[model samples]
Target: MDSMLKADTADVPARENAAERLAALAYDDMRRVDALILERLDSHVALIPELARYLIEAGGKRVRPMITVAAANMLGHTDMAPIRLAAAVEFIHTATLLHDDVVDESGMRRGKVAANLVWGNASSVLVGDFLFARSFSLMVEAGSMKALGVLSAAASTIAEGEVRQLSAVKDIGVSVDTYMQIIDAKTAALFAAAAQVSGIVAGRPSDEEAALETYGRELGLAFQLVDDALDYGGAAAQLGKSTGDDFREGKVTLPVALSLKQAGPDEAAFWRRVIAETDQKDGDFERALDYMHEHGALNATVEQARDHAARARAALSGFPDNAWRRALGDLADFVVERAY
Candidate 1:
């Protein structure tokens, strides 16, 4: 832990909109990627395109795809391959969001009505599948077996992670190891693949590929950790969902998991009733937040995210201090700072 720097939340030093800064840094490349995304989002089946477009155009940071482009630019690749791959990454991401909203029973996505609610679960799921297929088509267009293989493997890993999370929900006995595995697969896998595939498209060496993947993986872990911390408070609007969704759903995030480790019998019993039994009532969320703050669970989660953010920054050390690398590092900082 000493290897990673820690700052008071107020001293975290991120600008008001680090994401906007990142977008500005990569403005040209992102515009190309966005253009490609709009073009590839089309479908002959009217509903398919419409539903996918609704989510695609919905205002998310496009963080993961931007990572794809940034990695390519860091390696000095000027081809259109990264653009195609970035669009594919976005499609894969959008597909997962659609599927995840249904799985999480989330009412909103990107602050808009969730696709599942708008189009029905069946429609959302089938459209997710269509986008997934479309993502593969775009991956094929990228023309790298290595890139295709990594992204395809990430797709499977994401599903496995999602299933693992389902099993972990309400199970207070779940270890931190299991919890870490869940996030690594569910959230970090695609991030790693998105960056690693950039190396493939750029014909970089294995070491650079591994480093970029580490950057993405650690960044993903940090991103999800901050999100977990946010669920206990009023930042749900920033996260594009209602507050207390994780608590109401009985999801076992790191904050909850850590708080469980320190619980007295009474606290443990309360946890079992609410999480294990899903028998939550009024004041339960407040009680859960109390436990989290009492145990320093939220702050501890932020520290862990900061550690990953440090690792993400370190992973980019092999690259020069160019705008792309600097922006990538700043993005890592932004992810952890979001917890504040």
Candidate 2:
């Protein structure tokens, strides 16, 4: 906790629109990746393309694919293979989001109605499967078995993580370690793979590949931690989803877990009723927020996130001092700062 607090106070200059800056740095490559994504989404089945496009066209940061292309470029690779792989990473991410919205029963995504809400759950699921298949095809075309294996394993791990999270939901007894494992598998695995595969395709050394993977993994953890904190504190429009969605869904996130650990008898009963029993009342979400703040749960979670963000920035220290690496470091800072 001391180390996390220290890291949280360290100077990391905030950037305006950090993700947008990263996107701009990788703009040309991303343009190609976006084109390739649209091309791959094409199908003779009109409904297939229609559903996939509906979500793809809806604005999102496309951060995973940005990491893929940026890492490759940072490694000085000027080839089409990375572009193909970047597009593949985007497809994988998009597929996961589609599946996740259904699983989470989310009504909004990226400020638009979730695909599952607009289309049927069945349509969203099938389209997600279709996008997943397209991702594999793109991975195969990229001509790197190691890269393909990495992405495939990530996809599998994500499913396992989701299952793990589902099993833990409404179980207020979940530890911080267990919660970390869930986010690592559900969110960080793909970010790691997205960065690692770039080095694989670039034919970089094992150490650099390891570094990039570390950067992505830590960044992903920070990203999710901040998102969890935001669910309680952020505006719905800013989050592109409803605040307290996690509460309503009975998902036990880090803030909730921390608050539960310090709960007095009355607070314990409150948590159990809202989370374990899923018997939430009108003011329950507000009360939960109050408990989290009283327990310093949100700050603790943000401090942990700041530690991870610092580690993510440090992972890039080994790379050459270049625009790519600096942007990545800034992005890590941005991940934690967004919670503020």
Candidate 3:
């Protein structure tokens, strides 16, 4: 397991590592946005503030907020609105993570103990609500009804997607279309909103706004697909969670869906029984993985992710050639390359 983890980790590339990639933007602005995120996250309530702070400090890649900033900069907006929007996006995202941890009964996040694990599910859920409300307040401060519309719709879509995924749990007959819908709503919607809101805030042309939205949606879809793949392929320690955690939870993801579709009758029956019964033994996960490997479902899912990455890159064609745009492309590639 350790050797496999090392191998996978080694294969993943760092996103936006080159200094030249970020040279177009003023580092001072980026630092300012970082400070803004911290400052806006503050709350007077003792427990909520502490718990929210714990989750914020848990070291996410901040990819969604970065997308907002990059998109705004690409559209020639260097104002504080972008910074506030970036922080707003992060707050929304972090709230979702808190709720997600409770739903998944997750014990760890980004190699640290999860808020729910440390503070209990009730506390985590309430703090998540606080963040959600705070996110909307921040958006209101942005003073754009268009921005509010986009973000509010995204939030609703994400909820619907979560509910859809819950309905599909342990159901082996879940189709690729269903899987795509779930991911598009749950994962890609916020990315689309983030980029679109940035464009809206910058008063970009309709075409530019559409392009940014497309880029964000495709990038987010690809990111989640890679994440689902890693959940099965990654090491438990490196993932900061258990391997086959999704399977154990009876969550049907893309790779598993494809594998089920391709499985022989006996293998299909085994999957149905294990999943329906929620009786996942070590051998059950191994068998499911072996079937996925034999049917090339894992590779198929990876190919799909690569296709989305290509689409995301193509969406950036309308943007001017600049360091930020180039770095956005690099970031898309990194999403597919990350091991966990």
Candidate 4:
């Protein structure tokens, strides 16, 4: 379990310039806010700090936290509360990543060894729990019960989504509906909570809050969709894991699910045998990839991701034109275009 966000080749260009964009969203002192996050994340337990630092220092794009800060700035709040909220969102996200890596048995993240790989699963899981609890305490400090409610619900949804994915493993019949449900819970719920909480903290009207929630939900869907696509299309070094790792794990992503349905008899038969069999050989990945390409599922999946990205950008129309809002729009475009 690594708390780090995987940086795709598609994300690098946007990230390289993220500092400049972030600077445009002014606060009283953004650096002080960052320092607050670092200080608050500290723990008395030595091991907690060690494992947590591995994740914090692993260097994520910190995009979710950025969204929280940006949304608050757009709504005219530049207080410490927004910074605390942003840090809470990052903690929640990082905790989920730690748990996910343990569940997924991910070996590498961000071009480095995964926490689970370096520290072992037992320590990683416990450290993840500590971070999750720390996030809740930080949320309480924000003094908005509405924000707490939204975030707590999101955490529950994320867990459920992970469990749903576990149940769907090796099940070739996992429909798009099931996949959508998983992504909505596992990915979009957190994003929605992050944006919605930002609005709540800023005392935004309900309608505006709803709009931000929608924006986050759609953006998250687009982000995860592109992530699924990259699992098939990216290089091992670039992806920070082996290509076709999803298929190798018998995890049915969007591309494979669509491919299984559209495949002709021979291809479909291959999918059936490979998916149903618990003991998948090394060759299964190669064959599954070939099937995905032949059936045009890979391209179709990328198109679906792009469609979501477009929808995400469109959702920002509710916000007034500002540098932060415009940057948000550009970030949406960055999410999809980076897949190239």
Candidate 5:
């Protein structure tokens, strides 16, 4: 049963250590990005830095910023602009997490207590705003109006996506298309901007810039799709949050949306009672998982993620055949592999 939820990537050579390879390749640049993140987190307001650091130091993979650094390195960029943009990317992501935890009323984030739980929602939200402001400052320092424009738009798009998702909560009627659109904005926009901004700062060709954007967008989609599937079938240790957080929150994510479509009268009533009505009871989550598995919803979601990951790798084909390109490609596969 667990095997059914794993991503099918047998044709591709196994790269279970793809993230480690990419990290090793980009270690020095990542160190600089990390330093920049901590330095900019400073503030006289005391709680600002305290709260920001709480979330920032909470052991995220820094995947978004790493894309910025790796894309810049792949383009042979030799300036500090990539480092600045990468830090800016991390800030944007951290800011979003702070706000998301508050909205979701999340208890845990990255295996630790959510910042909002310790600092209160008001403090978490205000500090998130501070980080967003700081991100723009870094973008300005990076000195490319074009890059700034791209990232600024991404930030706006992310806000819109979150609001859209919030509005759709507990909506069993949400289509898979609607779910994709929501994630594209909420999760994938930053990834696209993070990668595209590098090409902008490096003054790469427009076509290459487009490719990077596509790669990041597709990868982000795959990443979120896998996350949706994992919420039902993955270990809490692997997810960094409880396995059924989405179900408990009544989030109409990809799996729920897919399963709802395939449900018959009895299962449909069960979904309505548990999800739409929020009358969840003991074993409701297990029943939901059973419905998803019975309908092959989890497997279907993972297959869709694999398709997106393949497209993400294909988007990198125009780039130079270097270690950076291969690492990015492998990272796409790794995104889907997380479902296992």
Candidate 6:
């Protein structure tokens, strides 16, 4: 354990509160985004507003919007474009969450009752569609075809990613590259777009835009890797759901894939029965944890996340040292650190 902690922190710089750092950097603009969200969330249909508000106001970290704002600030943007785009980014993310909760059949989100659980799956999905429409409309209102195209492409990619993931679930033979591809599309695509479009709106050069996109993609990948580890390593309260959710759902994340690769024949059969067949017995989660630890899969997953976090920081190398850059680097560190 001591050696694992040392290795995890090897290239990772210390950052006590990376999210708060990024939030403070973009606090004022985030407020504007918040106002715009409330304004745009309004609808004559009572259920639309109610369900949208419930999910939007839910205590998510709002990392995607913050990434949008931070990338804009990093590129010397001072206009309201970032603020407006930030709202659109938030809507895209919230829409995904609403839909995801229903699809995952999740009972909880951000430590509260899932919208689907409270309102029903039908309402949750429709509200998610409504938010998607609102997000696109917002991009149109922003009047940047380039930004609109970036986000629009991201939306489609995210859907495709989701579809790809649906196929991979319960298929224990999924490779690490396939797992990374799934996360890149489903999660990192938005992060990349949210950051890249800010550069576009700020009129940053193409290289800089690409750099921001890389930064966001690596950060998103690192974030998801950490989340995968946390499912087995973290307590239920920390996850806002039961631990081993990926295992129970028959989802094949990195830890599962890695452990499966290293499993003996007896262990492999156990995984096939539980994951491929979805026949979980009592203490299966505990045994899964034991396998993850025994094979060093969880620690390996965290180490890989730290590597992506480092890549995220390296992507910011061309940018000047400033609050935005610093906070973004810290945020990368915090993503990997969260696994601990």
Clashes of each: 0, 0, 0, 2, 0, 0
lDDT of each: 0.86, 0.87, 0.80, 0.78, 0.88, 0.87
Give the per-residue lDDT of model 4 (tens digit) for 108-148: 77667889989899988999998899898889999999999
| Native-to-model Cα distance after best TM-score fit, residue 102 in candidate 6, in Å | 2.0
Per-residue lDDT of model 5, residues 102-148, tens digit only: 99899999888899999899999999999999999999999999999
Per-residue alpha-carbon lDDT of model 2 for 171-280, expressed as tens digits? 99899999999999999999899999999999989999999999999999999999898888731213333478898989999999999889999999999999999998
Best by TM-score: 5
- Report model 3's TM-score to 2 decimal places: 0.90
Clash pairs of candidate 5? none
Alpha carbon lDDT of residue 188, candidate 4?
A: 90
In model 6, what lDDT does residue 42 have?
Answer: 95
For candidate 3, the C-alpha RMSD (Å) to the true structure equals 3.8
Model 3, residue 301: distance off in Å is 0.6
The lDDT, on a scale of 0 to 1, for candidate 3 is 0.80
Question: What are the models' TM-scores?
Answer: 0.92, 0.93, 0.90, 0.89, 0.93, 0.93
State the weakest 10-residue window (summed lDDT) of model 6.
1-10
lDDT of 3 by residue, 263-301 (tens): 888987888887766776668877877787787777778
Off by over 4 Å in 4: 1-33, 234-242, 278-283
lDDT of 1 by residue, 231-252 (tens): 8752222333356888888888
Q: After superposition, how far is residue 5 of candidate 5 from its true place, in Å?
A: 13
Instruction: Report lDDT (Cα) of residue 78, candidate 6.
Output: 73
Worst 10 residues of 1 by lDDT: 1-10
